[model samples]
Target chain A: MIENMTEIAISQLLSETQKMKYEDYRFVTASCVSLGDDGCDVIYHFDKDLEMKHLKLRVGKGEELPSVSKIYFCALLVENEMKELFGINITDIAVDYGGHMLLSDEELESPMAKQQITIVEKKGAK
Target chain B: MSKTVIPFGPQHPVLPEPLHLKLVMQDEIIVDAIPAIGYVHRGLEKLTETKEFTQNTFVVERVCGICSCMHALAYCQGIESLMNIEIPDRAKYLRVLWAELHRIHSHLLWLGLLADAFGFESLFMQVWRNREKVMDIMEETAGSRVIISVNTVGGTRRDISKEMLTKISVIVDEIKEDLKQVEAAFFNDYTVKHRLVGVGVLTKEDAYALGTAGPMARASGIKQDLRMTGYSAYGELDFEPIIEQDGDSYARTVVRLKEVYQSINLIKQCIAKMPEGEIVVPVKGNPNGEVVSRVEQPRGEVLYYLRANGSKTLDRLRIRTPTFANIPALLHMLPGSQLADVPVLILTIDPCISCTER
Candidate 1:
């Protein structure tokens, strides 16, 4: 259930990768996010002409996608930050994860998850 | 030789922001430098998507207070590009005026901070005291001292009157005289040279390979100023990219000092040639495209990328600050310097860890 706005059905991942590379877009980083219903969104950020472009690739909730850290040195940190923040798992990454700078293990219920959270307007709260 | 691990930061006096460094040392000489960031990460990137496009101007401005105006300007430029709005010619020149004022203030602030790191107390106070004039000018004109919230999506929110411009012109002359005194202290003084002369050397090749930006790269002989792209009213004005041959700490200081004069000159020209027009355009509808904008901030080059999906809020916004690109270069330079010179050397890159971790 990809919510992408791409024109075609991007079934061939290798061809898409080749197409992106051929277009001269340097792969900057890929970050993972967990969605409900056994689905996850893997966002790949690329840069060319000083502009950042995001492409979302979805996988099963427990599945893994390919890593681009081999292509860009900056990706390792992005993948780690996403894993720590969104409770998504990344595989085959080279550098140290730096062990989750912000959150602890028990609080990994995903603060960023799109769930029912209170939004009390300050004007009427008191 | 065994490589002993020595921790360099997280609370080092040399760095303005908290950046942890684990250095592998052989006796007093460093062999490798491993950097650990996120010490001050406030998740600014995630927050930008949540904030309204107008409000993000303030949020992003706080990304680095030293380069606040530049941050806001870059964000505005991206939004303007998306909207296909051509700001008035007068607004363009006004943007240059305020932005150059920001550059001057940021560079002087860095010079003061650098002097303090070297224990040159008198020089530090002199530079910062002179910086107050720029702050006063900013507050008087833009309504805020540090995070001057003048930049808007289509143009700027504030407009300078003819009287304000005359006052600003007088202030610029006063600040230029004071900068000359500060420069004399930095260049002619024996102690500053003794400490910073040969410390933290990065050759031109190393700087280029590591993608160092701003004065750090310029000091290493790379004349790649983004101002040459003719963004804002810089294309209409006459100026030159400041460059230096030496890649040492002192050379970086020289480059910044020279840039202060360039910024002052740029502002003077803008004031002289500024025309009368609306400060901003009426921005309508939702911006719906991906646009990239680059601006030369005090530390180096700052890149802002904005992606909108035809909404009031942007879908994604990413900032690649100069400090972020310079960190890798610092990793290469930190090794091989003496232990005591770590603070001085660390400061040479003008590491804004907040900007990096943001």
Candidate 2:
């Protein structure tokens, strides 16, 4: 399990990210864990001199979260992926792929957060 | 001057993977380069949640064929931490041994690609020809060449016999000897220097700010390597993070070239100090916690985020591969670069689309 994780409000996302950037912490990557009916928990991982630090933010379902790409331009890719795959609406990504970065728009929206679709086989032919 | 936009990839002679860049050119100079990815996306992260925790080990290995062992190693290490299971010392040494061998072959593969980017076909053939010896060593020892599934939850699934270890040691020495023959062409040749040196420069400030990892960061004089975190036998190993300060394509090339040598030395050290004991331990329960693991792959640091519940299936698995993190730096370097140097510049980052899009 991870250590040194500090939970913060979603409003503090950009400012906290800016703080890490000011402190010279390398933005490792962010992961969004969908809580289903409970929205999502977004975690931002960072490292300074190989010491790991993490920030966790809890957001409501379908919430348009703020993008940290302004503070750290490198976060654009993950933010866009989160937008496309998790159905999390992130506002102002440095490079927004409009939900088509890692996936095409026609494939499936928020494929990770969506409920499982079971396929029913046609029995007449057999 | 007229502005012309050129699409650089998704198909190119030098590209090893499908990475497209929309290069905005003003005459012969590139003004902006917009990267277009997802061409190889398989939605593997989303797929991980459906599979049981144990089965996901095999799934993660398929993310990228070249660094499959490292992927397994990181996944297993994270699971072991969640379960509080301590792998045997012999298992730890064996992990390091196989990992360094992967590094040797991976760097060699990059070297060949770099040579090919500059149209040095003979050099490319020679480098890959030497690389086959490493593949042979892995096949002989692990019974699989590319995606060697040697790692498991508690420890390793296989063990190397003493005779095989001796053979690996001899083969690696020969690899070191063979690399020297192509060293001059890469390091001192006029065409290579002309194409690589001073092109796509990333200063130390830009590298850190852009959050680049592995060789992209290290080559620009950042002393950040996840190996220094020492998850496995890296703590006991004797090595330093190779750094080059020039912040140019040549500097990046030199950094990886030196790393190939360093990996050879580390492999030799592992062979000499490998302890004999049980390679695995039994596990009793599913991992029921959240964990993040980092491993230094040949390209750079790869981060894994895993969330498991009390059941067999995992809640989520997120992989922030090194190539994904390096794309911003690549875009940053693209501007103010020559149009002809785009492919060579892309190769310098050693982009792996499978790993990035996974």
Q: Count the backbone clashes (under 3 Å) in each candidate.
A: 1, 0
How does candidate 2 fare on TM-score?
0.96
| Recovery fraction of native interface contacts for candidate 2 | 0.87
User: Against the true structure, what is model 2's DockQ?
Assistant: 0.65
Docking class for candidate 1: incorrect
Candidate 2 clashing pairs?
none
Question: Candidate 1 clashing pairs?
Answer: B214-B300
Off by over 4 Å in 1: A1-94, A98-126, B1-3
The most accurate candidate by TM-score is 2
State the lDDT of candidate 1 residue by residue for B1-358, as single tens digits: 8789988778867666777888889999988877777667776877887888878888898898888888888988888888888988888898888888888888888888889988988888999898899999989998889888888888888899999999988988898898887797788789889888888888986776555788998999977788887899999899789888989989999998988889888988998899887888898888887655778888888877566789888767767788777866777777778877788787778878778767
lDDT of 2 by residue, B1-358 (tens): 8889898889888887888889999999999988999888898888888888888899999999889999999899888888899999999999999998898889999999898878899999999998999899889888889998989988899999999899888988898888888899989999999998999999999999898999989999999898887889999989799999999999999999999999989989998899989999998888898999999998898999988887888888889999999999999998998888888889999989999988
Candidate with top DockQ is 2
